[model samples]
Target: MFDINGGELIVLFVVAALVIGPQRLPAYAEQLAVLVRRGREWISQARTRLDEETGDLGVDWEALDPRKYDPRRIVRDALLDEPSTARRAAASAVVGIPPAASAPLVGPAPYDDEAT
Candidate 1:
C-alpha cells in the first residue's frame, strides 16, 4: 500500500541504523513489529464487531462491495432481474399461487409422512 520498493527499504534501513545505532536497532524494530501487529488486531476486532452489529439488520454486504459499484455492473443488474426470481414469479402467475405459497417448490419437502 505504501508503494515502497527494495531500494527505498535499504535506504531506510541504513538511515535507521545510523540514527538509532546498531545497538538498539533490533530492539526498536521488534517494538515496531509489536505495535504494527497490535494495530492490525485492533482493526480486525473493530471490523468483526461492525459486521456482527449489522448482521441482525439483514444487510446485503455484497451490494455494498466497492467492486460491484461499477457503472456497467449497476446498469446490468438493474436491467436484468435475477433469472431465478423472474422464473419463480412467472410460475406463481401461471399456477395462480402467491410466491410465498409456492415456497415448497424451492424448499425441502413440505409434507412428511410423520406429519400426515
Candidate 2:
C-alpha cells in the first residue's frame, strides 16, 4: 500500500536515525521488524480462520462482482433461462432423489385445490 521508493526509504531511515539516535537505532529497527512480523502473523491467522468458517458455503463470486454486471443480460437471463445445474441439484435434493435420476420438470405443475 505504501508508495515508498528507494530514495524515500533512505530518507525515512536517516530521519529515524537522527531522531532516535544512531546509538539505539539498530535496536529500534529490530523492534519495528518484530512489530511488522507480528502484524503479518495476526492477519494470516485471521484469514485462515475466516476461510475455515466460510469454506463450506460455496460463494458465487462472479454473481456478486459489479465489474462483470450487465443489467440487460441479467434481466434477460432471469426472464428466459431454464433452471441451471445448481438449481437442478437443489430441486433434486428437495425431492430426495439423486440428480441423475431426477427428471426435468415437464409442462405446468399439477394443482391440488384441496391442498391449497
Off by over 4 Å in 2: 1-13, 82-116
lDDT tens string, model 1, 77-100? 755644577787889999999888
Q: Against the true structure, what is every candidate's RMSD? A: 14.5, 10.6
| TM-score, one value per model | 0.49, 0.56
Clashes of 2: 0
**What is candidate 2's lDDT per residue for 1-116, written digit by digit as tens?**
89999999999978888999978988988999999999999999999999998787877887889999999999878756777889889998998999998756666668999994
Highest lDDT: give the candidate number: 2
Residue 96, model 2, lDDT:
94
